[model samples]
Target: MEKVRVLIVDDSILVQQILTQMLDADPLIEVVGVAGDPYEARELIKKLHPDVLTLDVEMPKMNGISFLKNLMRLHPMPVVMISTLTERGADITLQALELGAIDFVTKPKVDLSNTLDKYEFEICRKVKQAARVKRESLAEQYQRFAHNQTQKPAVESFPTTKVMPKLSADAVIKKIAVPSKFPKTQQKVIAIGASTGGTEAIKEILMRLPENTPPIVISQHIPAAFSEPFAKRMDTITPMKVIHAQARQKLETGHVYIAPGNRHLIVEREGTQYFATLNDGPEVNRHKPSVDVMFRSVAQACGPNAVGILLTGMGADGAQGLLEMQQVGAHTIAQDKLSSVVWGMPGEAVNLGAADQIIALDKIPRTLLEVLTLLN
Candidate 1:
């Protein structure tokens, strides 16, 4: 098999060197070239024609964001962000994702050499996943983001308007099936788990939901400083009230509780009332706010009243927990392989016989809504 060719683009020669060594260590990855800045990166991109590009956030001549926007508009492909762990870096990384990045690997917070090896496995894995991303899917996302970035917004809504995809729910849903289990005495709560490509996937599903939709709890693998902004971003576009998970907030219809960064979001029920909590314990599957943690928690807390939906991602973090949810009579669904940027998580769930339905990304909302309507 041909190795996944990569180009490292960073202002720091040191980071570029370190990344080159680390990425080259993997037999499946080949660092074809390295560029000091976007200008050089552009030239190298045209020449090398690499499968993946690793980009830094801060650059000398043009910032990574500006270059990213331009690149998406001109020539789109899979790009992975290599970012610092600072607050500002976190925000920029999220912006890159919205701008059409496939995934990111956070730089060492401190003791660079010591911690660099810690992410060696992760960096290589992400690059491999990125190389597999369907170019058409990324191209479409870039077209959407680039189109919105340049257009002028209406005066009144300009302050808060976001560029959401124009795709309709009917375009993706093959068939909507109601849960076989009828409504129990308790209300049903939806639990969603995603990583990698999930940020946009979640946005698409939630934005399609009605204001009267069922309550939702999400475990989206995100960095420490990006979760709140993600929730705020979703809130601005979707009618559903999106909030970072609070210690004791009760789950309510039409509201979404997103797991805060660096913590796991879990649901616990006392009688009919379901509440969300943050778990600061050890990371499961190398992710805080792990889908496995949240899914397992939901299985114990909501049981038959829970509905699990696993979306696009690159790891098996949520697969086992989803199986547990299915075993307990909770309806479980996984995003179909074709629509996913990286289908690892959902594919694993389907492989484990965890999903009652395997649906397309756009169809998730309609299928979910159909499930809710079937219940009490």
Candidate 2:
């Protein structure tokens, strides 16, 4: 098999050397070239045509975000951001992902030795995953990129009133029905699993829920340092209490538990009560905090009392587990393609007959509420 070619773009020679050493240790990856800044990266891109690029957020000639915008417009490719672990870095990294970078790794604030020791394995894995992403053409990406860039400035300058799209009652009613075999009891727990476009999607659903919503357990694909802040941001806006799942924390109504990034969160029944179990299990579906792990556990522990929601993501990570839930009499819902950023996960569940109701994004929360009411 051919090796995955990579280009390292960082101003620091020490970082370039360390990244080259770490990535070269992996037999499947090949370090094709290195660049000190975006100008150098442009030259390397023309010459080497690497499968992946490891980029630094801050560089002398041009900042990473500006470079990223141009790169996506002119020559879109899989780029993994190397960012510092600061609030500003987190905000920029999130923006980078939204702008089309495959993923990001938090740079160590301390010495090289400490950073490498902590992040070597993670960095290597992200490089491999980044290599697999399919990028859009310069023209196609640029059209959207330019539109987004101009839209914000235009909106701020003109201050035109924009209408919010509302979901019709008929559209909402179509997705509110419970499955024929849905258990006639309160669905006290909801287990949600999503990857890729989950951040914004989950926020939309959570913000729409009432303050008295049932307990929700989420397994969203995210890196280690990002989950805590993501949960905190959600908690501030939503009435529900959102936090990263901790081992042995009891599952309570109105509380939302997000699986700690890189750790699996499973549900266990202790007689009449349910609690979370955080474990360092082997990666399932190429993800540590995999949806499959959480959904399967919910199927076994909660059985008919659970509701499984599979959301927008890029892979079939939650398909099998959704099936298990359906087989065990749990009502399952998958996000419809029209509203999904990537329809892979939910599409797979629908194909496998796991989803009882396939709903549009805007209708999901309300549908969930109606289902819960009927079941109750």
Candidate 3:
């Protein structure tokens, strides 16, 4: 197979060189060209027709955000934003994603060598994934919507306030056919993994858990700076104690520990207590805080005492690990397709028979509650 072609666009020569080296180190990726600014990148794009572009947030001639807007309007393609690891950078990167950039990576200012080594795995993985992404041009999206409208059969208008009947607690509870069977007599831990549309999905699930819910270890694929604020925000709204995982922190019931964006969080058991283990190991499934690594650890440490949840994400990052959980007799649940923003991860798990229960997004919390109750 042909390697995924990539073009690097950055104002800093050092950044361009570092990123190019990191990407080229991967056998599945090839750096086609490097540009000092958008003007240079425009010329390279025309000449090389690379499959993916890695863009720096700040450039001398034209900023990445403005270039991204024009790119989406005129020639839509997969683009990943590389920004400094700062508050300002995080805001800009989020905006870039809304403007159609596939994803963002944070560049550390100090200790460049160590930081680059820490994030190189995810950066390369994002580039490869971005290459396979099917970008929708503004024109194409408009035309597709128009076609759908034309194809729909005419119907009488219905009342806007005719809300669909909500599922009752019993009805929702009955849908969780699979038993958790977790040994709640002993300490229990919940390990969750998600990516892609995970941000909103995680919030929904975490917010719904009771104040006494078991401690949760979550691995969501996201940038470093973003995870801190994301966890804090979840704490404000949720009944459970939600915060980013810190090294050596003791696992406490009713607290939700989100894995730091660029590091993996593993569970280490000591007698009757458990603690967080943060490491900079090689990326599993091309993610540092990989769901696979976390799940596998939970499988070993907690076994039947754990509840594993694989939420909406792209790719098969957590499938095998979730299967491991099932093999160990741990309860494993995956989010169903209709409620997922992108059904890649959970779909793969369901297809592979790794998931014990597949539940809709809204129903997941209730199902989890039922499972916890049964386990107790």
Candidate 4:
């Protein structure tokens, strides 16, 4: 098998070194070259012709975002971001994703050497995933991204390869009892889960939704620093109010609740009302805000009153939970492979007979709204 060739672009010598080492450690990956800036990276790209590029947000000569814009517009390919775990970093990383990055790895803030093992797994896995992104799929995303950029100059919106013990949803929340009883409440709830290409996918769906749509709960794999900004960003573009989920927060019509990155967001029913609850439990499917946890909770709390839509992402985090939702008679949808940047999650759901409908990214909003109409 040909190793995935990678080019590292960072201004810091230490970062370039660390990234190179981490990527090289993976037998499936090879560091073809390293560049200190975008200008140097351009020259290296022409020579090395790497399969993927690891980019840093901060760099001299030209910032990573600026370089990324030029690269995507002129020569689109797989690119993964190296971002810090700060508010500003989160914002810039989100912007990079909108611009066409396949994925990202957060840089360690403290005790760098100590975290290299964990960081190694994350960076290597993302690079490999980025390399696997179909060129046609990436071109489609860039075209959409370019179109969105022209409309408004703003942000937009994977997977588990972990060295640590991979735990299932049971590690965090128990599975629903057999022959789960449907909740008596007739009010409907919408639950969405995604990872790799989810931020933008979720944004596409949310922006198209009517202001009067049902209560929405989303679980997108993200870090603690990024989820708040992501919710705020969605609030600006979408018609509904987007909020970071808080424990015991009431689910309201025309409002969206997003799980915080560090905690699991679960839906619980109290009498006739549904409330969002946060769980600080062990990571499920290698994600704190695991989609399985949220989907499972929704299945238990809302049953047939719920709608589960698994969007573009890597890995199989939400597949079983979506199946649970389906078994309870909830309408389920999965983003089609051609429309998904990485079809791992939604594809898994489809394979498990979880989705009632399979729709493209652009048509999901319409399909979801139609489902909402019938359910109501």
Candidate 5:
């Protein structure tokens, strides 16, 4: 197999050097070129023909969002954003993803020398994941998005490799035996887990749902700086009140709770009501707000009265937990491959027979609504 060719685009010489060193260290990736600005990047893109681009959110001459917009419109390709751990950076990075960037990695806020190994592992893994995306599918998705359609594209199957061994959901919560019978319940809760293409996908689902939907809880793999901003953005667009999950926050209907970055969001039942509980446990499946932890908690708390959906993402983080939900008699759904940006998570769940139904992206909202009606 050919190595994934990458182009590093950043104004800072230090960032350029760091990115180059990290990507080149991966035996499956090669740093083909480096550019200081969009202009230099354009020239290098034509000359080097890199498979993926590591773009900086803020650049010297022209900003990364503008360049990304133009690039996706004219020359569609896979792009991974390098962003700072600031609110402004998070907003801009979200915009880049809206414009067609595959994923993003945050710049280190602490000493780079001390965090180089972890940072390198993240960036390199993202770059390789971006490289695996099909260009034609990206172009199709971009055109539809340009026309305000909800249809997303599919990614070609690629090996989901891990740079370092990762901990499973068991690190945070132990698995318990699933009960053969579950008591009927009138109240229902919705649990969602996503990564990579999730921000846009989540927005699509939320924007289509009515304001009277059940209480929704989400665990999207994101950084600490971006979660609140993301929830704010969703609240503005969706009919539901979207809030960043607070410790021991009460879960209410017509509201969506998003897990804070670096904290596991779990569901617990008190009397007849549910609440969002936050955990500061170590990373599970190499993610702080692990979907596995969230799903497992939902399985335990809601049992037959929960709906679990795993959307597009680049790893098998939530597969087992989704299965656990199924075993507990919860209705579970996985995004179909045709509309997924990356099929790793959902596909894995399907393989495990965890999904009660496999649905397309555009149809998920209606399907969920129908299922909720049947449950009631």
Candidate 6:
């Protein structure tokens, strides 16, 4: 089997060498070249033709963002950004994703040496995942997003220095599922799990849903400090109120609760009512906000009254949990392989016989609405 060729580009020679060594150590990967800046990277890209690039966000000659934009516009390829875990860095990193970068890895915020073990694991994983991304698919996404991005509501505007709003677990619960509160005993729930290309996929589902949708609990793989902005941004575009999950907050219809970054969001019940509960325990499936945790919780809490939808992502985190939901008589759906950005998660569910139905991404919202309406 041919090893995946990778090119490392960063301002620091240390970073270039360190990342090169780490990626090269992976038996499935080869370090084809290294560049100290985007200018140098541009020349090497033409020569080395590496399968993937590890790019630094901040660099001399030209910043990563500029190079990323030009690369997506002209020479589209799979690139994983190496970024710092700061507010500004998070914003740029998200922009890079929007511009068609496959994924990112954040440098340790404190004590770099102490963090290397974890960082090395993630860097290798992301590079491997990135290599699997089809360049043509990224080009399509870049074309798809370029226009819709410009017309978003001003409330969703970016780069704000203002204090991001405090999001309690149920902060936006008013008038969930409709203009009226859902009956506690009969309330239905929806659980969604996604990663990789999920940010855009989740947004599309939310944007299409009516204000009368059931209470939604989402576990999207995102870094700390990114989920808050994600929930806030989702709230602005969708009629359904979006809030970050807090411990033991009641789950209500017409509201979507996003799990806080780095914490598992679980749905639990007390008597007849459901609440969004936070699980800060050890990471499950290598993710603190693991989709499996939330899916299993929803299965236990709602049973036949729930719907589970698994979207495009890179791993199998939600596959077994979706099967749990299926065993409990819950209706389960997986995004069909044709529309998936990466078919790993949803595909696993399909193979596990977890999905009751398989549908395209654009069709998920309507299928959900129809299913919920029939149940009601």
Model 1 deviation from the true structure expressed as Cα RMSD, one decimal place? 8.2
Better of 1 and 2 by lDDT: 1
Superposition TM-score, candidate 1 onto the true structure? 0.86
- Superposed by TM-score, candidate 4 places the C-alpha of residue 89 at a distance from the truth, in angstroms, of 0.4
TM-score for all models, in order of appearance: 0.86, 0.66, 0.61, 0.94, 0.91, 0.85
Reference-based lDDT, residue 258, model 5: 99
Candidate 5 TM-score, true structure as reference:
0.91
- TM-score of candidate 4 versus the correct structure, residues matched by position: 0.94
Query: All candidates' lDDT scores?
Result: 0.83, 0.79, 0.77, 0.88, 0.88, 0.81
lDDT of 2 by residue, 181-250 (tens): 5334353789998886677678768877866787899999887777777788778757779988887798
- lDDT (C-alpha) at residue 77 in model 3: 87
- Which is the better candidate, 2 or 4, if ranked by TM-score? 4
Q: List candidate 3 segments past 4 Å from native.
A: 1-82, 91-102, 107-186
Off by over 4 Å in 1: 109-114, 146-186
Kindly provide the TM-score of model 3 when superposed on the true structure, using C-alpha atoms. Answer: 0.61
lDDT for 286 (candidate 2): 70
Error of 5 at 194 (Å): 0.8
RMSD of each: 8.2, 9.8, 10.8, 5.7, 6.4, 8.3
Better of 1 and 4 by lDDT: 4
Clash number by candidate, in order? 0, 0, 0, 2, 0, 6
lDDT of 3 by residue, 1-376 (tens): 8899999999878777888889999999999999999999999999999999999988888988889877876788888888888877876776566466767778887877667767788899888877766665323433432443367422212122322132221221111223344333457888889987576577668766777778899999987888887787678757788978888888998899999988888887776688888877666676777888888778877778888899978878888778878888889999987766567888988988989899987677877766665655
At residue 294, candidate 5 shows an lDDT of 96
**Candidate 5: tens digits of C-alpha lDDT, residues 80-150:** 99988999999999888877899999887667656655788888888888988888767866775676645
User: Which is better, 2 or 6, measured by lDDT?
Assistant: 6
| lDDT assessment of candidate 4 | 0.88
True lDDT of residue 368, candidate 6: 82
